[model samples]
Target: MTLYPVEAGNFKLDGGAMFGVVPKSLWNRTNPADSNNMIDIAARCLLIEEGDKLILIDTGMGDKQSEKFFSYYYPWGDHSIDKSLKKYGFHRDEITDLFMTHLHFDHCGGSIQWNKDRTGYEPAFKNARFWSNEEHWLWATQPNEREKASFLKENIIPMEQSGKLHFLEREKDEVFSENKELGFGVLFVDGHTDKQMIPHIDYKGKKLVFMADLLPTAGHIPLPYVMGYDTRPLLTLPEKKKFLETAANDNYYLFLEHDAHNEIITLKHTEKGIRLDKTHTFNEIFN
Candidate 1:
């Protein structure tokens, strides 16, 4: 099995919102803010290539939103899914599975795109079976007021409309063991979003956990830096604490989604609790 880091694009988001109640004095040291206080964020996705299946985990926010809509997030950079795929000699049509960690726009927007006629939306990955759990599917489709803005309909509805959406069956804490096809286990996490699935991939004799919003960046390794956007921020505290302790103990590599500068990180049990042990690039760790 081969894993590739797909660069979807870069965007900016308010540092305060990203760091939640954490003081700027602390987070700014790791993710510095611009004059407008927006920090750089990457919509980095992962591509898993096994025998006959090419599975993509998360498709960064697509380019379908209006200028006014995109202005809010300040999408930047020239890196795109197409370009990244081409870099590795792959194409959209080759993907057999689109595994979404959650339905947030930044994570799943690339699942669909405007049709050629511009009349309606269509599945971006024409050949892939889109994956989302039943719980997260419902949570995103019938979003609460706090999360409604992040779960854009255009980015989601088309997956089901295309008749390729598949829901993974997983109860709380259930782990999907490594299989020859996917080469990974899936751990369901709800603190960031209801039933968000975090992929536990086995690569090169090491375990790499895709850190979706649960641990957006290495700076978020601390237990208290939960995002304010989470519907239940309180639940994130213990969830993060437990996850970090296990990650540190097992020497797991964290694949960050939103961290612009850092791709992977490892944790150590420090006096102040679990802290970042080191950071690595995809090639550094896997190659």
Candidate 2:
């Protein structure tokens, strides 16, 4: 099984929002902010190429949103899904599965794009079966006021409308379950958003986890460093605590999704609880 780090896009977000409640004095040390207090963020999606399956996890912010809409998040990079895919000699049309960790605009935004005529939105990857769980599908479609902004209709509905959206069922009380079709286990996390699926893949004899929002960056290794955007920060505490502890114990290589600088990270059990031990590039480890 070959795993590729797909560079979807690069953008910047408010450091305060990224690191909730945590004092700037603390988080700024790891994720330093610019003059506008914005920190660099990457829509670092993952591409899993195993046998006949070509699964792409979390398409980054597509170039469909209006300039005014995108101005809010300072996008500053030439890296794109097309360029990255082409770098690895692939294209969006080749993706068989589009597994989104959640339906947030940044994560799933690239899943849909304006049609040739720009008359309406359509599935960006026409050949792909878009994946989202039943619970998250409902949560995203019928979003609450707090999360409404993140769940955009244009970025979501087109998949279901296109008749290619698929749901992964997680039995009640099942924290981690294997998806035979995707050939990986997804850890169900709700603190960030309802039922955000974190992929746990057994890649080339090493355990690699897609660190969606559960642990956005190596800086978020501490238990108290949850994102402010999370619907329930309290719930994030235990969810992060449990998962991070397990990650540290199991020696899992965390594939960071949103960190612009750090690609992959490993954790260690320190006196201050689980902390980032070392960071690695996808090529250094996976290649």
Candidate 3:
């Protein structure tokens, strides 16, 4: 099996929103803010190539949204999914599975795109089976007022409309360890979003956990630095604490989705709490 780090794109978001109640004086040390108080955010996705299947985890924000719509969040960066895939000599059509961690626009927007005629949306990965759990599918489709802005219909509905959407059956707090076909176990956490699936991939005797929004960056290693975007910030506290404890104990490498500078990080049990032990590139760990 081979894993590739796909750089979908980058955007800017309010540092205050990203760090929740954490002060700018504190978070600015790790993720400095611009004059407008916006911090860099990456739509980093992961590509897993095993035998006949090429599975992509999380599609970054696509370029289909209107300029006026995208003006709210400044999307900037030369890196794109097409360019990243070409770097690895792969194409979107080669992807057999599109595993979404959640349905947030930044995470799943690339799943669908405008058709040639510009009449309607179509599945971006024409050959892949889009995977989203039943609970999250419902949660995103019937979004609550707080999360409605993040879950865009154009980014999600097309996958199901294309007749390629597949639901992964797992309850909250359930871990899918018996599924060997994917060569990874899925841990379902609901604090960030309902039934968000984090993949626990076993690679070269090491455990690599995809830290979606649960831990957006290494700076978020601290238990209190929850994002304001999280629907249930209070519930995220214990969930993060518990996960960090286990991650620190087992030496799990976290693959961050939004961290612009850091790609992977490991944790250590510190006097204050679980803290970052090391930061690495994907090649450093997998190569």
lDDT of 1 by residue, 33-116 (tens): 999999999999999999899999999998888999899999888999999999999999999999999999999999899999
lDDT of 3 by residue, 141-256 (tens): 99999999999999999888889899886544554533466667887778889988888888888898888899998888898999999888998999899999999999998999
Instruction: Quantify all predictions' global Cα lDDT against the true fold.
Output: 0.90, 0.93, 0.90
Error of 1 at 284 (Å): 1.0
Q: How does residue 131 of candidate 1 score in lDDT?
A: 88
lDDT of 2 by residue, 59-158 (tens): 9989999999999999997999999999989988999999999999999999999999999999999899999999999999999999999999999889
| TM-score for predicted model 1 compared with the true structure | 0.97
Which is the leading candidate under lDDT? 2
Residue 156, candidate 2: alpha-carbon lDDT = 89
Backbone clash count, each prediction separately: 0, 0, 0
Q: Indicate the worst ten consecutive residues by lDDT in candidate 3.
A: 170-179
* Lowest-sum lDDT 10-residue window in model 1: 172-181
List TM-score per model, in order: 0.97, 0.99, 0.97
Model 2 score (lDDT):
0.93
Cα error, candidate 3, residue 56 (Å)? 0.0
Candidate order, TM-score descending? 2, 3, 1
